[model samples]
Target: MNRRTLIIVTAVVAVGLFAIGGLLYSPTSKEVAVTKPVSNEAPLVRPHSPVFGAKDAPVTIVEFFDPACEACRAFHPVVKKILSEFQGKVRVVLRYTAFHPPSEEAIRILEAARLQGKFEVVLERLLETQPRWAPHGRPADSAWSLLDGTGLDVERARRDAKLPGIVAVLNQDTADVKNVGVTGTPTFFVNGKPLLDFGAQQLLDLVEAEVASN
Candidate 1:
């Protein structure tokens, strides 16, 4: 080969190796810091608090979820299991991504439930019964049915769902997802670092590692 060709080949090889090394070593970098801006919107009412974990918890897991997404449905149990295992050790923040119209309604219902101080009960019911109600089309009927079981008056729940303030909270969550560059359902963030694996064990491992280091 000519001297120029050899030089070009060497540079290309070096660049390729650097790219591979960066990918392999990237995870060891320090956690990214996320600064959430203060919003004038009213606080959401819900169980376990909207904050990802105990304010004192060492690790935080932020999850962006879509109510009608099948993958989200599948992820709920995994999240529940993790929470049960790590209870107060890790903080988990759940944000609605609203990728579908039904998700908007679902977010509204959740916000309304928060107003009633029954948000956790309502959220669990929705996640648990998603398979029976969430199908090919809009799940408005199913959503209504689930709310009915919450023992909070159905008319009151509907009214709360339509409130402008509740809708604003949903919008705020949607904005959060966009801000974080989350493009899909059930994306998890450990200490503000996005976990692409989506597997329960992988996610737990990341959280555990973060906690151990602290």
Candidate 2:
């Protein structure tokens, strides 16, 4: 081959290799792991209450969930069971990620309930009746029905739902989800480490080990 032709071919090959390397090594936004505190360094707890043991417990389980998610509803019973089994040994913090319309409304109601200091009671009732209330692709009315039985004054609950402070709390939760890089519902963090592909039992086991270590 002529010298110029050979040089041109080599240049083309070099460019092709560079393009391939870039595709292979470039870091995309989705590839990044969410950074969070390893343990006690986490910031102030949000307005919502943690499930399971006392606030001062040795082990903490933080869950990011969407209320209208069927998977989340399926996990509700197991979560309650975990709280009951662990009692005072662990604490479960639930952060709302309203990924859908119904879930958004449900979160608003839950936040409103918080204003009345009945958040836990309302949450339990919602979980217990989630199937009836949170059917797939349904509207927010079912959740409202469950809230009706929370013993919170209906007028106060409605008013609080629209309160500026409660809206701010909900927005904070959304920001937390973004900061944590959570892509879906029911994501869990044990002692601040991501629990990828782990089941509820595995999660509990990790919590127990952490408690034992501490």
Candidate 3:
């Protein structure tokens, strides 16, 4: 081949290789921003949302949860398992999506428990006893009696549940649930990517992928 022709071919090959490299490159978590999917707003993590695990963890699992949801109750342990598996690398931010009529009261109980630093404990108890209180197509019989040994001050929590601050939190979470387009309980987003497949294994795999990317 002529010298000029060889040089031209080499330049073309190099350009092609560079373009292929760019196409093959996958963005890491640090390179991407986790925002609301439709509106392209800021990160979905709200300052007032109840978070589980390291507050500064690199991976975030945002769960739009309804306290009266049986699926949320079922998936509670699955989420805990993911936290246990990831340790300090992942955290869960729970937003109240109260689809059921009784869920607001249940959330009030939880938020009040949060104020008293008993969020996790109270949550476990509520879920553990959920079936008794929350039957499908009906209001929860009432969760107050179920808090018997969960270390929450029932009387004080009842009063605190009525607080304007607590009510505001509930209001904001309800608004966010609508704004974010969460139609059901236990809808999960891993680093802003929705879990469309919707299963325990799928959730675990998504978390694993995000953690590895980070």
Higher-lDDT candidate of 1 and 3: 3
Question: Rank order by lDDT, top first?
Answer: 3, 2, 1
lDDT, candidate 3, 46-76, per-residue tens:
7888899999898999988888876576556
Best by TM-score: 3
Q: How would the candidate models be sorted by TM-score, starting from the highest? A: 3, 2, 1
Clashes of 2: 0
Clashing pairs for predicted structure model 1, backbone only? 45-114, 52-91, 52-92, 52-93, 53-91
List where candidate 1 sits over 4 angstroms from the true fold: 1-49, 137-140
Ten-residue region with minimum lDDT total, candidate 3 = 23-32
Candidate 2, residues 1-214, lDDT tens digits: the string is: 7543443344344334444542111111122244554454342246454455688887778878787765565555556556666778778888888886677778888878777888788877776677676666554346776666668876778787888877877888888778677777677777777666345555667777777887
Give the local distance difference test score of model 2: 0.65
What candidate 2 gets wrong by more than 4 Å, as runs, is 1-52, 138-142
lDDT of 3: 0.75
